[model samples]
Target: MTALALSHPAVALLLPLALLPLLRTSATPQAYPSLEPLGGDPLSAVFSWLLRLAGTVAIAALILGIGGLHLKGQTITKTGEGAHIVLLIDRSSSMDNNFAGRAPAGGEESKSAAARRLIKDFILAREHDLVGVAAFSTSPMHVLPLTDHKPALLAAVDAMDRPGLAFTNVGRGLALSLDIHERDTSAAARAILLVSDGAAVIDRKVQETLRAAFAKRKMNLYWLFLRTAGTRGISEAPPEGEPDTPQAFPERHLDLFFKTLGTNYKAFEAENSAAVAEAIAEISKLERNPITYVENTPRSDLTGYAYGLALLCMLLLALAKAAEVRIPRGSPA
Candidate 1:
């Protein structure tokens, strides 16, 4: 329900002036020596009352117009086919390199640039999804909150290509992405798309907290691992001589950690930009679900309508005055 409101409510203090028209008539008065033979005419009495009512209406409308009447803003719930998604992007300095682990040259695009382009296309395809963006290097940066606003989401994606810090703080970034989802109370399918060319060992304490959070909230998790040429993959096992540890193979261990969380997790190892695009397409196909979201409608102004009504009433009063009968001086009483 929408409620009526006023911009200048103080102007309503003068509303009592509308009653003045009812107290007195605008017609000229005629003198009479006696009242015995002069009887009230029914038609004249009705017409006089109508004119007073019109005058009252005009005054009341004018007061309301000055007060600046309007309807308050509203929030409407809508059903749509989309999920609540958070894009957790890696912004470490390594993302600036091409898939071959070198500076992009001769029309080659960096990993960050490819991710931005493909993510923007994904956003545009899901017209109804509420999306948020976050980036991680040495720390997590909250780029945007969950919203269905497309322009802002695209702008946030555009900022992901900026020069980044040295470290890949994956654990904190995941925590921030989960927090963004937690704050949104809407009933919808939840998913997190983590895009990175590499990973770092998560702290034990952070891993426990993430496990607890994941256990509490069931959501889809997708990792788009942009693997460079000759680099280790997420599922690759270490060589025989090297000890199997998170420090030696962080990507493989991170993938293992996600699997242990009991959420629906999938990892896509993309060797190039085309592979990344295909992985994003698969994720899009997987996340289609019914969602309930709230959309806000801005307030509407009714000042012009109020003034129009006042003008209508004044026009009626003017016509009544022109048709009024006048008694000449010294006419019979």
Candidate 2:
């Protein structure tokens, strides 16, 4: 279906001017003294008509182009299951190690590499979900924003290329991820999937701010803990002496903190790539419940087509003039 729209609709009021060419009168008299001879030749008469018609068409096409015509169409895009997921990833040095709790050598797959592959897979499975990604070490770095464009999302995931600072600032990572959500006011389903093998203490004020955001937006938070072998996971309780500190059992303490946020929260602990995949698969199932969303198809400009048609008409007009048979004024030389 094709529809034409003018960028400058006001210019369309001048479209009547295109007809001025039809009323064209020669500023100078034609070489032929009278039109009586022109009528005797059928081909000559047809050529005159052809030339005028082509001129009219070229003028019309040019007018339309000046008016900025655009072909508009409607595309009914179904926004699949509504979930805006922001991947809050950890970029600490530990992420450079493999799932077997060993440091990666050249060309070896590390925790970050495996996580990236699995996350890319997860995105492929959730075709409708708008996802963003962020990475944190000393501070949070926003790698991507909430977008459903698969290539951009995958590229952003791949960009977590090297090990970051040794410190993990989960607070700043969470703050940045939530800020991405706040940027979009839509009430569509929201979730934050935090993938990290470590945790750090969050500031008290930031924690309060995060809790408010969680409650107001009614966000679902899932922590995918990629545990290193022999390290305490989310299920582990803090040591008796360091229960008050988040440093001793950082993952578990953070898990507890998440549970108190008064919004939907869950934690999944994974020690291997397979386990991480399984955790993402489980989250996939839980978030599949349908929610309404709107998709937009951008308008397309078609002035090039108009311009091309105009060019064709001008070429035909030139050819007709070139093939014209003109009578000799005096003697045939």
Candidate 3:
């Protein structure tokens, strides 16, 4: 469905049931409904207890009434609703492995294929949102332009089927997304959704350049880290009968860089294709607060109302106490 077709301010339906207590009587009224049976002992403690009970019920009713009113008054208006999204995908050799999730035992879906499956799902689901695609291997490449053209985007995703060891370039990928977003005349919210299996093989200078560019443009960063068990055809073993010590891939350095980037970026760790799609759906709904609301975040003002009701309860208690004092003990007047 198109994002525009989706409901705004998403409704959270709540049913109020506590108001019923307000209509109930303060106590199990004696058949005559009065304290006459207490020997008219106005100072009878039972009368005071009844008054306090009534006050407690009244306060509860007030709280329920206020909650219902707030719910009824809720409003969600679309301010700058049509936003632009950039999808950054990694196409390194590790993306060609079988670790994502064993595709049914006999299936032929490779790792990149599975990731593309997720990309397609996300694209198809976003009917109204403008989207762009950038694929990163040795460097970032703009495979698709920013547009609402679903078919083109899907085709592009399906076409990225390189099966060799390619280095990752996250910084360049992000820079490309920023460039595309700059072209838009009225982008409501410019955001970058990066999907990769950890770090890039780019230099620090390039990474800094991308970061500065994004900071200057005031864009939000969303990172998705697709996990990998390891790449296929990689042999960690030594010659037969030969002793071998474990050696980490040079990519470990790249991993550290991404860890730092992920710290500042909105990150998602996708264990498999299904998770990737789900993450996209969730991230899409994350609404950035309007810049104007930056100073004072809205807060629920139930405290004042609660205090008022509490005071009413205290008043009821006092009245009940006074009535108890006037009544005589054990004698009907």
Candidate 4:
């Protein structure tokens, strides 16, 4: 079943041109007494019908040639695999300093710089994933929306390569990060990657909101904590012969809170750039979910074929009319 589509459908308004021969009468001069001789001649009747058929066919082909008829089709296909990932970064003032508690020198990258570099690599590594960026300091900033456009996501990450504010509003940032996927209707997997070194106490209401958001979807939560030298972090261990001391560091307590959020959650404490790269590598492994995409084929033109057919029919008409015979009227014996 093929469908014909016209590029300029309005051109069909000239369809009445094909019926011109049918609407008008054409008279042929004939020598006859009382017009009875030609009416009874079988050969004359056949010639008249043949002439009309040829004229009608020629008119139809010409009209269609001008009208422009074509067939168009579209297809949607799915291929490869990917997920929707949101990078939630912390931009507190302390993030500007290197993990060694000193300003970065000799081109040494700071914690935030390391995270940004690694996150950019993570986004580029995925082939079809929709990646977004969100960073927070004293407040939440929506840097980018979820999208499969890699350059825009990478550029948005690079834009945050400046100084940070004083506060670290983790709760609000996390809450805003959840909103990135709230209205998603795609089948792609969802995940939030948090890159931060310090932790701030979240308000009770904010905590409740985050908890509800986590439970509302099947989302993966990964925290890539930048652990400065000689500072306690989310993975703080107890002394020998003692139980685990999760409360020893504020980040550890935050880790505990995330553990209770009823989602697939994991925390990695990276002490250096190498560790940061490793953490992102692990994340790349987890983002192997299958994704789908659509490809469109270019439209093909059919007007040329219509015009050729019209020309061929007109040519045949010319040959048929040339074969017609006529006798001299006054020379008959």
Best by lDDT: 1
Candidate 1: global Cα-lDDT?
Answer: 0.91
For all predicted structures, in order, the TM-scores are: 0.88, 0.76, 0.50, 0.67
Off by over 4 Å in 4: 1-79, 237-248, 293-333
Question: Compared with the true structure, what per-residue lDDT tens digits does model 3 show for residues 1-333?
Answer: 111111222321222333333455344433333656666665646654566466655565455444432222233433433357787777777666655444334676666676678778867765456778888778778887777677898888887656634677666877788788878766356678776665645666877876567556656677666666443112223347754322233234444444455333566666666776777777766634332111222334444554576577767756654554333445674
For all the candidates, what are their Cα RMSDs to the real structure? 2.8, 5.6, 17.2, 6.3
Q: Which scores higher on lDDT, 1 or 2?
A: 1
Residue 294, model 1: lDDT of: 74
**In candidate 1, which residue ranges exceed 4 Å CA deviation?**
7-17, 24-37, 63-68, 71-73, 297-304, 328-333
Native-to-model Cα distance after best TM-score fit, residue 75 in candidate 1, in Å: 3.0
TM value for model 1:
0.88
lDDT of 2 by residue, 120-152 (tens): 899988877888888888988988888878899
| Cα lDDT computed for each candidate against the true fold | 0.91, 0.80, 0.60, 0.78
Model 3: how far residue 177 lies from native, Å: 1.9
Candidate 2's displacement at residue 191, Å, is: 0.7
Please give the lDDT score at residue 269 for candidate 4: 89
